[model samples]
Target: MDISGAGALVTGAASGIGAAVARRLAAEGAHVVVADMQEEKGRELAAEIGGVFVRVDVTETDQIGEAVAEATRTAPLRAVVNSAGIGGAQRTIGRDGTLGSAHDLAAFSRIIAINLIGTFDVVRQAATAMSTNEPDANGQRGAIVNMASVAAFDGQIGQAAYSASKGGVVGMTLPVARDLSASGIRLNTVAPGLIDTPIYGEGREAEEFKAQLGSHVLFPKRLGLPEELASVVLEFLRNDYLNAETVRVDGGIRMPPR
Candidate 1:
């Protein structure tokens, strides 16, 4: 799809990878819509990118639908980035081995609802809007980019719940892509390795951890920039052929067992 003049809805656009993708797409002429729970940050980002700010909590279907509807008022919907998610850590057994308790359920449910269900809600709602878009020469209606993480592949300790949710997301890629294929929509996910985003505190990795990652990664020793992830989304939307795949953006860093 030609990004120029295309309407785009990006969840989690207040900061990190989503913000970068929003800015990049807007720079390329897409009418970007920044949807996030952070009203202040979301509005600021929308202003910065000359995009619309539709405050949305992706976990709510009504909120997601409303945001998409608002965005479509400008241009025919063309693209969506499902970047809204949260990371959490929990243990199956506490230090006393009391078996998973209320805290465990809370952490797990929250993570799954926000990361897994949230993505699904955004995709389902936005896809409905995108299907209404006129197809391109290749019969392509639109594109959807979802954010997964390296933990889905190699989750460290204390990440059981988090990892499971992300794994569910990564696992759905092929099926979701194939399901949406008939609608002329492409679906894909990006599993980022340790990136230099604010998600990592101060972008610091333990020396031992750094050494371990260096042993596996092929290139780019340092953390990945948000722009690197955004670049992949841009191409995925532009190419018209890439589909139903989860491309790892990690620098070959398979997460270690914590």
Candidate 2:
């Protein structure tokens, strides 16, 4: 799919990898819709990139639908990047082996809701909008890129909820691609490792954590940048043949059990 001059929606575009992807896509000439819950940051980024900001909470179906509508309102809906997600750390059982202190079901459900179901909802709605678009020369209407985590495959301790949520994303790739193939839309996923993002905190604490995590990385022995992840996302969106795939942008690091 040719991303230039198309309507692209990126969820969680307020910061981190999503923000980076939005900037890159805009640079590629796509009219980006920065959809995020952070009004101030989302609006700022959108303005910086000459794009529009749509305040959207991916878990809210109505908000996502509205966002999709706004994104496609002025141009053909061609690309969607599902980057909105939350992270949590909780063991299945507590140290005292008490059910009351174990992982909270509500927290687990929230993670799944935001990371897994929310991604699916965005894809479903975006694909629907893209289906109405006239197909390009390659019979492609649009492309979708979803965010997962290395935790999905190599989850450490205290990551049950996060891992399960991201695992759902990885599991859905093939089936979703097949389902959307007939509609001329493609689906894929990106599983990032320990990237240098705000989620890891700031200053000395973040540096220390990065060092510890970097030790596990096979080469370069350092954290990845958001731009690196965004580059992979661009590849997934540009390459028409790369469908139903989940690429890990982890710098060859398979997380160890904690």
Candidate 3:
């Protein structure tokens, strides 16, 4: 589980929590691969960390394979963080409660494809690469950290698609870890709450909106920081004893259904 001089692949590394995790891994001496769809930002961050960037759309198997391959080229792939996901909010039925007003099928499908299926595909590919590595003294080849959300548990109104996708991640953690146990590849999940990220808009209006959202937190009365979430990811990667667990990084807040 030692990360130094190893290779780490983090999806959605262009921004938000994924970006923070990528930087942290690099700082820990891992050869980080910034896998994201945003070329400009991904390349910028990769350069910043002296790492490599691979434009990856997790839903595409070919792109995911390329990312895994890229990581192996750097070093023995030992760490992977699946932080690629999208958010969608729409009521199952519109205000009028009419048939045509049902949630958009395409939108729902897209969220699931990216958040759930995409995460699984990347993990599978990464595990395959890690399986080839010689185990360390602890008999550990690698570890994976998957990004889930508090929505997977306390989903609010209009969060059907997002919740379902994250729920799928939480549900699969134990089984996936068990499957990877023989290969010495451990898997865990982090279910984060409201973290200050680009998902919130910019400028004064956005700041004001974010403040209101932060007020709901149980303590410190503010949104979580991306670095705080990244720290937990590092623990998951470095702590060989951790596996098949979903830890929530929320500031003691159980979301209220709106």
Candidate 4:
């Protein structure tokens, strides 16, 4: 689990929690790969952190392979953070209850493809590469951290697609970790509550909206910061004893179904 002088890949590193995780890994002396779809921002962050940026769409196998290959070129790939995902909110049936009131099948499928299947693809490739790495004293070759959401547990109304996708991520953590155990690769998931990120638009109105959302937190009365989540991610990677666990970074908030 010693990532120093090794390489790390972080998907969705263009911004938000993924960006924070990428920077943290770089600061820890890992050759980080900023894998993301946003070329400009990904490149910018890569340059800022003295890492490489690979334009990757997790759903595409070729693109993910390229990113993993790039990460391991200079150093052994020891850390991977699967943070690339999208959000979709649609009920099985709209209030109208008309013929077309059902949730859009394509939208639901897209979320699953990206959040669930995409995550597994990256993990599989990353593990394959890590399996070739020389193990440490504890026979640990690498560590993986996957991003989930509190919605996976406390899904609200209209969050069918988003919740299902994240739920799948959480559901697979233990089994995937078991499968990777022999290779000395560990897998864990972080289920985050509301974290302040670019997904929320910038402006005074946006601040007000976020505040209303934060009011629900049990303490501190604010949304979590991306860095806060990033810190936990590092722990998961560095703590060799941690595996097959889903830790919630929420501030003691159990979301209410709206």
Per-candidate Cα lDDT values, in order, are: 0.86, 0.95, 0.97, 0.96
Reference-based TM-score of each model: 0.92, 0.98, 0.99, 0.99
Q: What does candidate 4's lDDT look like per residue over 1-258, in tens digits? A: 788999999999999999999999999999999999999999999999999999999999999999999999999999999999999788888788785988999999999999999999999999999999999999999999999999999999989999999999999999999999999999999999999999999999999999999999998789999999999999999998999999999999999988
State the lDDT at 93 in candidate 4: 88
TM-score (C-alpha) between model 4 and the true structure? 0.99
Rank candidates, lDDT, best first.
3, 4, 2, 1
Worst 10 residues of 3 by lDDT: 93-102
Backbone clashes in model 1, listed as residue pairs:
193-250
Clashes of 3: 0
Which residue runs of candidate 2 sit more than 4 Å off their true CA positions? none
Model 2 C-alpha lDDT per residue in residues 117-157, reported as the tens digit of each score:
99999999999999999999999999999999999999999
Error of 1 at 136 (Å): 1.0
Count residue pairs with overlapping backbones in model 2: 0
Across 68-187, the per-residue lDDT of candidate 1 in tens digits comes to 997798998888998888887766777765664434687788899999999988888888888888898999999999999999999988888888888988998899888899899999
Q: What is the lDDT of residue 165 in candidate 2?
A: 94
- The number of clashing residue pairs in each candidate reads 1, 0, 0, 0
